[model samples]
Target: MHEVASQLSADLLGSGGLDRDSGLRPGAARQEVAQRFASVVADIASGAVQFPLPGSGGTSQRFAALRAVAQRDLCLARLVEGHVDATAILAELQEPSPGPTERWGVWAAEPPGEGVTATRTEAGWRLEGLKQYCSGAHSCSRALITATAEDGRRLFAVRTDGPGCEPVPGTWQAIGMAGSDSPDVRITDLPAVPVGGVEAYIRRPGFQHGGIGVAACWYGGALAVTEPLRSAAQRRPDPHTDAHLGAVDMQLHAAGALLDRAAAEIDQDPHDNSGSARLRSLRVRAFIEEVCSATLCHVSRATGAGPLCRDLRHARNVADLSVYIRQHHAEHNLAELGGLVARPENTR
Candidate 1:
């Protein structure tokens, strides 16, 4: 597993890789991140590295791989996770497999804004409108995008290299996770192939499983943010730092154990036959999000502003994680979870 981490780090940050010095401009940094992501995707296509499918019994191994990538670069991990997730969604829906070297992204973010709308043309389906938070916007060759259709919300696969899809420049002005290259994409009547029926994307069992996979990435990012504090404690040996470290350990250890148990349960019930996947995913994601949030607090409180000012990697990890974990809907998700727990069916 360490070797896997090292290999991923090397692939992403070694040699003609991401400029980690913090001196490079955002344009250069975004280009480098995209290039590295493309290289990693090529490697995956070539069988040099492979991620296990969710609920494949090797789900722990899959999470480990995501963690390894997030530990090094959350931007890359975001793209990698999206690509792997696209493949998994396609497989689960019995859609045609992606091309050998095609890099895919899942652009299902439905935040309040003008979103893509799907129309059935004489030829086929066509999409239009602007989709926000399209990560790997300029880098992905293909994408599984969700758009509102005549019937309901549906998922569609579309080629991004075509003429109709354009990534709106300057839309993503984020300081954190900027290397993800997420931008608002304007889909202007782009041809698309519908992957599944209305609402199928969220209705699948894999939807819950994928949410946990994201939690796995959050766990890894938390590990990355905790690194400087761990090193500082090792170097200085202060009681105050040790106390923070102890708290971090407790949080991370419990989070990891929960993740492991969740993975095992996923393997045991890949199809959600036991009807617990939704509740389990919500709990795992919420728990891990809290753990990561706590870790950031502990590390920052223990280390103060020095690391944020001095260490580029640590600063980036801190910033990236701060933004990434916001994907967990916090109070809204908690309310939903509460509703589930209060349900008569769930009580039994």
Candidate 2:
């Protein structure tokens, strides 16, 4: 799977087709990359690819796989190299595929509490107000935007455009996942096709499925950072540093188990919501952040500031992971999951 992801990434980076104008039209190379990514994900779902390592920090492997796929696709679409906006690439994928739409939309509305709004307009539907923390927004061609209609009811999927939407300038600076480019966006009088009626959009199967993909991405990034730490641990002789490595390893393992369980629940029976799945996701994310942050501290403390000056991989990883960790609803979702778990019915 890693090899496949690497090939796809290389193909995308090497493909001269990626450029500013490349986003203006959907080209074969972009489609091919998307198709390959979809195939890899399918394999994962089908158990063709193993996820979550057996012992500690297995979740990192899963996250690495997910990131490789997403990053490769984004690269193919020229999103990472800065030639194209991430939102546009995502919009292209949102277009209907040849098979039944296995694709799920991952959306996050900003302000963390207010719902999105979509109203009918002469030019399709006018989407007004803010959508906070939309990861892949720059690349997502279609999204199930949560908004309230003029009538004050929750509505969704109003206007959709890849390039038409622009990032709220300068909002996304953070520590990790800088390449994610999950920036704020505003839609004005754009056109769209409703995937389902307002209520149905929120209640769709795809909605639940979306979380798993994100979980996978988080897990992968955790692995990417941890691998270096593991290497450092092997080389270092200090017992104090070794003890920190042990703690980081344990945290990673626990997080991976949570992710694996969540993935199973999502694949087996998506609608159940059991609240456990969501809780597991929250657990994994929190644990991942903790472990990664600690690893950074340990490595920096042991290696000293010398490494920081030589090459920026560690710093870059820290920065990227920090930003990526702040996906929409992260804290709020965890709180909601806690609430649900505390409820009597959720105990079952």
Candidate 3:
């Protein structure tokens, strides 16, 4: 399944099928892209395009296909000079049966000031507050912000450009995923649309799946880091170095399996909230952290600091993977796993 998905992704890349300049009508292009996306989603639903890790087996390809779809849409959006909020799209895909009247927003950040209210106005909602750590802010047409209201109801889904809503430049100076452009945005009396009901955003399956997806991305990053090392090891093997490479390989495989199990559980029961699913995600992330840490350490030890030359891909991989693994839930996730295991039920 991964081979087929890889072929499709390769074809999309090779033929430039997703290119926005293909002269295809906007509607046609949208349809085509949507079709491909649907295909990918179907593959995911059917266990055809398994995520976590796509080895050459029945488990199917995992994170690579999902990332390919995401990258494809992002590139297409860039070419068309239009943007789609990937977080929102993922949420919608995960929750297809959301109520229409219930607006849905994804605002997870610390409020800047106090008593800032988000109100509904004639044109749109008036949002006055500051939103920080907006991951896809620059590229999203609309933002689901969390702001206080005069009545003290925390409001979400303030427009990005309506009225006084402003996108203050994001302060994201991270080493990895610099392209994510997560910045702090300021909204002052901005006109906005309300998303789903209060707390609706948190209740969706996508919210949990998004965490898994993040793990998947890290999994991909680990692979990206390991691939070069694997190639190098194969090309030139030393007995001492072979031992280190074997250890790295074992860690990578274990991490991949954990991610795959998490994906399966999430897909099978989107609303489980079971310790098992949470444990799976937590475990996957932990393993990924270990895998990346070990792989980088082994690479550095095996190859020495000479590979730190700016031109070396290994150096960049090391840097990127190192930074990427520290995303929102690294230590917290590990801690959560610890808590879960400490529970009486888990002890059994």
Candidate 4:
């Protein structure tokens, strides 16, 4: 609701767009993104950045803000993912932390090799091994990481810039989402503070709600890709172009409406307290993913390769949205939904 966030979004979408070089190099882009995003967060207390989550608005409003941010720049949107998730996790655990100046990432991506394990030490809990998909490793000062402890899976917060913390650059090779800087990190006995007990991270109500928030970002990306086709259709009355535009319009509209519905559901039943959060999230994310895929297809087909071949921002939006929506687990997620739907209580 505040003008600061809207101004920032506008600035990002304007002349602030990245050049081809910065677009390709993630490390270079991450630092600027980190600083800008941290500024946005810091301005919250100053009545600048109006994040709807913990403020006057509810869950539904949060998605609106997320969608707006993601539509402007996908990399900028990536900045919000870890920070908000970590904040929620810490708040749920009721752990004290430094001021809002600190940025955080949630590193739950299971490492391909050895899992980061925690061992009890006189100082506190210490983490060992590697954590993959550590986005914002360079930018984020602190992180909430999931690791294997002696008892079971658990969550811990650690200082990424502290001793024994090492970010393994050149680990992420993908062209898309490269600006996200989601690289692997080698934690050689990094000191950690346990945020919650074993299984607490997974069992938290915010986990499912967080999944739905991601869908809002996907919806925004999908909507962004359709803009070119919208203009194309308006210029010429080609039935084929109009047909695709109509489809894209309908798809994006449905996606937006669906996001609104998901938000309303979340706000009415905060933290999935109704035991329906999982099913609701599964349906919302899967449907949004489907919309994103369809929008990408229809938009590309309608506008042809002109945008992808020429426009950097549009091309990046297409590329980034393609990768971001892949966070959708597809068949596995569908199977989980099917099982949930088959439950007698869910049926009722």
- Highest TM-score among the candidates is held by which one? 1
lDDT of each: 0.88, 0.48, 0.51, 0.78
Whole-model lDDT, model 4: 0.78
- What order do candidates take by TM-score, descending? 1, 4, 3, 2
On lDDT, the leading prediction is 1
Which residue pairs in candidate 4 have backbone atoms (N, alpha carbon, C) closer than 3 angstroms, thus clashing? none
- Cα RMSD (Å) between model 2 and the true structure? 8.3
Q: Give a tens-digit lDDT track for model 2, residues 95-206.
A: 4322222332335354655435677877676666667665544444445565667654443443244544665776655324444445677765555555445455435443
Off by over 4 Å in 3: 4-62, 67-107, 111-117, 120-124, 148-155, 158-165, 273-276, 328-330
The true-structure Cα RMSD of candidate 1 reads 1.8
lDDT of 1 by residue, 1-348 (tens): 233455465635553224665324667667878887888888778877778788887787778788887877888889989999998899999997778789999999999988999999899999999999999998999999999999999999999988999999899988788888899999998999999899999999999999998998999999989988999999999999999999999999999899889989998999999999999999999999999999999999999999999877788888889999999999999999999999998886
Clashes of 2: 34
lDDT of 3 by residue, 269-341 (tens): 6565563655665666677777777777886777666666632344444565676566546677778889998
Q: Which ten residues in a row have the lowest lDDT in candidate 2?
A: 77-86
Q: Give per-residue lDDT, candidate 3, residue 312.
A: 37
- What's the distance in Å from true for residue 228, model 1? 0.9
Evaluated against the true structure, the overall lDDT of model 1 is 0.88
- Candidate 3 at 98: error in angstroms? 13
